[model samples]
Target chain A: MAQLRSLLLPTIFCLGGLMGNYFDRYTQSKNIVAEKASLVTTTDNKCSLGDIPSSAKEIMKFGFPSCENLKFREDYVLSYNRVHRTANWVIEHLTADKVFQRDFKRKSSMFKEDTSVPVLFRSTKKDYRNSGFDRGHLAPAGDHGYSLKALKDTFYLSNMSPQVGVGFNRDIWKRLEEYTRNQTRVYTDIYVITGPLYLPKESAEKDGKRYVKYQVIGKNDVSVPTHFFKIIVGDNRKKKSNAQLQLQVFQMPNEKISKGTPLDEYKTSLKSVEKASGLLFLDKASSLAIATDRSAI
Target chain B: MAQLRSLLLPTIFCLGGLMGNYFDRYTQSKNIVAEKASLVTTTDNKCSLGDIPSSAKEIMKFGFPSCENLKFREDYVLSYNRVHRTANWVIEHLTADKVFQRDFKRKSSMFKEDTSVPVLFRSTKKDYRNSGFDRGHLAPAGDHGYSLKALKDTFYLSNMSPQVGVGFNRDIWKRLEEYTRNQTRVYTDIYVITGPLYLPKESAEKDGKRYVKYQVIGKNDVSVPTHFFKIIVGDNRKKKSNAQLQLQVFQMPNEKISKGTPLDEYKTSLKSVEKASGLLFLDKASSLAIATDRSAI
Candidate 1:
């Protein structure tokens, strides 16, 4: 965290709770021009969520975890958190064709304010401008390689969460995303739900009781999650019933992670991730099948 | 030009002509994955060039100046020149609404090979990798604010010409682009033609006859233009006749230009740019009207 202090100035000494009112007003009207311009043209030939397979949609309902201020786009959807000024979860379905695409080059730029969000509650690029944390994408752009617009939509600030840039974002987290896409080779299509987790840990205590503790960055007090999670449900179209569905859940810390670490080492049950984030995922019917057919990591 | 030598090796000294066969074979297969991925998704409901107003279309016919292997996208069109490994010109029609967009951030990356062009003749980012010159966009991404996809399309290597980075690309040329966009405040829609100029001067002579002398960068032999040109045609749709049509043509040297220099100082005639590039623009019918009703610079 000393590196964090070096990169940021603790100019506003008040607690995160104290800046809510000011943050509300600032995000409401800031950067309107840039955000609005992109919205108008992006809607062309957008694919509707109705196109989402019903079985995949069923899992998405619970996996979203927190539905506060949910936002929808043709390629993906999310439940946004005005308090965190970031997404609670971003959900998308990646088909085999999307995973196979390699045409468009990545557009690497700073994250932008997601104008599609209600102005008062939207996050601004300024929130992370000089803040030490990288604006990491919960719904990775590399997965949407099939469509340029889908890839561009991923850049919207609402899809981003603050995460360590060096070892975490550029290293382990990136490898995890690549691994997820690589799984597309084995499944016909995959439904993904990715979000941050702020769970109670022994390292931080408030009022002599251990509680979940994380740093809040920028004027908006965007909560930096202690860890992040990805819940994946893969569809094996060849099977007749839900029996063929494959579920893989992973949770990783928001800290330096070694490059060669096996992904199986970080595997966790959906039930565990749900408890930490306090969000339900998968209905009992689907959960029962997963429990019976679960494969050993 | 001397500054360029400092940033690039003066290797393969025979001439720009010597490596044509090698460049032809290499660009054909290099970076196949990145370029091919984008072409698949970009074809969604593309806006046709026929949508351009008759008057604007007439002007574009010549401003594209050459119809050889013309490439068309939703927002703009250009004629690809295999020898130069860049567009002879990129022509676009911009409305007031477009000039005002500010939402999306610029994607900063090195030039990529344009897959839309014939692979054997296209330019690659590697050509400019250590060549010291910037892969400057003939069609500035800033002007395509109306659509993020349009802005992204501007990144294709076919639309780029090698430019001096610091003083030219960053300073004067950037300001000129801003000036052009600012004109949107007065005109309803504007037609723009921008490209490189490989004009011969008295100083560069062979056999006492002036010959075009320009540097070739990288192993690909991508030609570096000595100057650049921009021809803008603005239409005041409110006016019923040709009285509303306004044209401004400018030519700037590919060297350091002071920020404070007045734009009028660079103003030239379309005929001059046409003669130097050996391309005809604004066919006889439209040329007659521009000559008779040309506005003062």
Candidate 2:
């Protein structure tokens, strides 16, 4: 049974559940985890084609689910890239298990809470007043074909940003996806968060989604393109009391800061935060997973 | 019966079963999709305390049949997100008609090959490859708490890559896991190919498992540390006939090209196939679900 469990439930994250050294038989398999343990990961079931039924022609496909039903996993909160909670058993379906492989992996239990939490995909259909604003996805759909819910979740109002798909297809957005996934080859267990900045509601919506009118970033300016990054130190249910905690790193064209020709166009931008969370990246993130853990701080 | 099948089997790929939507109904509620399909996502089956079964406190906290063993739908592919596939029934469980709500999901039609595949756990203690290789993971475990098979598949050799886990932590890993799912959110049918780049003469091996090594990107770099990518493209498969067509993608990061800032430091480092096998991102793709629609590309 233990061996079977190991074969069935392959993972090394017992710091939250069950990680076997092979000598021991245990199945520390749970969707949400909190306790004193460690984890190890592998890609045993990474990618392979599934057996198609004789009715392969008859099997139909599903589209995305709804915003009202966008269930957020209480797992980890968004740290960098996009707004995200710890993944749930269901979100696992959004992954391309049979296509890509985890070429490399490493983790830091030494993470700390920071101000910028990257909101990846929330309910794009909902808003901040906790109103009808849709949670937009930093990532887009028509990209992930896992399910109507998973794919549609990518289309959530919260997941929305008013940008042309062609813009993404052409510039940084397209490069970003290819760079991260296509090039890096990372295939699992990553937390992300990406959302828009609110300074007196520049864009509003009826469905409560969002009106992404502009970016805080500018071109050719040294201090151009100032974006916020929130390094979530914990899970979504239990987050730091406020958004002040920040490990916010500002992004700008290097030409501005460093010596370069045609480098005169540089304007540094500033973003205000209620408070600032200390740096968490280069240290202390592993312990937060166990113990009583935490609850939406 | 069509409506029943609509609710029962959501696994068919429409583009000759290549681009069929990949969704497992059990993962998320279709009603949410019917309601908020425009944007945002609502799922009931996101990972949670409920997933920890009450029967086994140590092993199964999220709970279950000790562990859930699943057979690939006739397509051999399994959708754990908001979609699930069944022949002619939408039974949530073998014994119950209850539905499941999942956060992320992968709607698939690629399962046209195998019987139920085994989801394995943990890297083998022994590296048998003697090629300085390690059974790397293709899928990271953090993303798929939703699907046990997704997690276990990370352990498969087919998906393993020679990588070093640094800089990338669980938070990022999880985000990347979800990101990969989202990245693959397109193409009705996608064929991914990956494997080791080379076999070193004196590589280490333990328990029949090889310890693969990948270069450290930013760990040593001061100005721009951790800047590298792993990938290989072009068709490398032995073909039986010229008539056979294949979808080739740069699956994993091979030491040959997957280790540097290819885009920045190495221009012309990337390759273009002139014409991709199919349309990549079709804005509002559903309208083009049919091959003959011809609005995209």
Candidate 3:
């Protein structure tokens, strides 16, 4: 029971109690504040991708998160989730030269269906019509701006998420994209993973148990994530020996975010984002989980 | 004339051609891209304020700027400039506990005259009356909110700079203040110096030479600053040994700033802001100036 509580509650707090829908174990924990403390960070002052290996290892680099719908593009790799009709996460490797050399402007592109995904399971532009949500890019077109083909490939419905147009997509999220580009100016290289999060705010009590709640949208029943997460794995440019990676994670609400809300306010521990998303990077997944469980107990 | 051009051209490029008031020295020197390489940053991984002595020196620790008009308030120190009727810089040393432990709210206090300044040069609220500028804060009132007396002291006319009210003061500046507060969460301590800049843009070619130009406001002829700068000296919380301080400097136009503009866009090197403002900070003033001269030559 102690081991179960340790594993169950850290994941609950990591999901911020939003994962109660999947497990009743989250309902058993009453120490919400204490449990949330399980989130953590680890840093090594080295300048490489650390343990995730390289692009050549492809999808296996971060161990696929139980979802096999993977697409590897020229610049990024992503895993599509058939149930949600959105990419589980889009991963991209960015370098200073690659970002600075690009001078492309945003061009209009049709959100075409991914021929890669089965037609019956793929999301299309039709589902988003009049949904009052913007077809937000998980892997923003700006990151792929160096290549016309890469830029257009970002328009595929597979990379799109249902983002609120006004504040979240147009304002704060747009700023985050620019911030990522600017980081390239300082760091030699960085790996980025962008995805949607459907965590719940309130829990419904039913049959002496709690369940997480969220909303869905469109004919495809695409999930309207309660928040969005971006995880950055960075290599400090000055430190080239042993290739130690520094990590920073940000999770923002799916609501209106005011301008200049310091990025620090949204920064959460990378361990938590990994637990919530079930996606692992950097070779720390098993060790982080062990540490989380031990800390919880 | 060559010496003047050397000194003058460096300042012009440092201003990034924002000084159109100067001769087409900016346009003539088409190397705006190359000249900007003068911006340099030096870092020591030590965690404490270097060469500033220690906390026993308190506000005097950072070494005072040359202004004789100094205000040693309960929580902060400022070097006032009688000509502009604003502090050349408002200096504050902030810690996480002092900032976060307080629950104080912003209270409206009548802007009053500072009796400390000589009557001949002191500015008054009447000067700003019907003037199309907000009594912008150099050291934001928010930083002093912990003490009612300290908060009221911020209302003194001497601490105010003439700033555009809406977007510049109420939005971007406010965001910057909050961003500073947020930094305390990570750094053990940080020293902030906020001030205004009066640099010339678009040189006026006269008698085969150039001169800097600017505007003034109200009866007191308070010089309207073309830009504002904030320099932050931070101690990495984890590295406390030899006291290596990390530095980041920002300069912003005294104009309407759009919401969600990435902070990185406004980031300039410490060397340039020092050259533009002619104010020395830390103990690197002389060395930075020498470095600047070398880079220019």
Reference contacts preserved by each model: 0.00, 0.01, 0.00
Q: Chain A alone, TM-score for each of the models?
A: 0.75, 0.29, 0.71
Q: In angstroms, give how far residue B158 of model 1 lies from its true place.
A: 0.6
Model 1, A110: alpha-carbon shift in Å? 67
Interface RMSD for model 1 amounts to 32.1
Give the CAPRI rating of model 3: incorrect
Better of 1 and 2 by lDDT: 1
Ranking by TM-score: 1, 3, 2
Error of 1 at B241 (Å): 4.0
User: Quick one: best TM-score, which candidate?
Assistant: 1
* lDDT for each candidate structure: 0.60, 0.22, 0.59
Given the true complex, what DockQ would model 3 score? 0.01
lDDT of 2 by residue, A151-208 (tens): 4334323233333233222344433333333311232222223332321212233432
Model 2 alpha-carbon miss at residue B208, Å? 68
**By lDDT, highest first, what's the ranking?**
1, 3, 2
Residue-level lDDT of model 1, residues B94-210, one tens digit each, is 777876785555664335677755444567888888777898988888877567777777788888898998889888899888888888887876778888876544333233323
Where is model 3 chain B poorest over a 10-residue stretch in terms of lDDT?
B40-49
**What C-alpha RMSD separates each model from the true structure?**
27.1, 26.1, 26.1
Which structure is stronger by lDDT: 1 or 3? 1
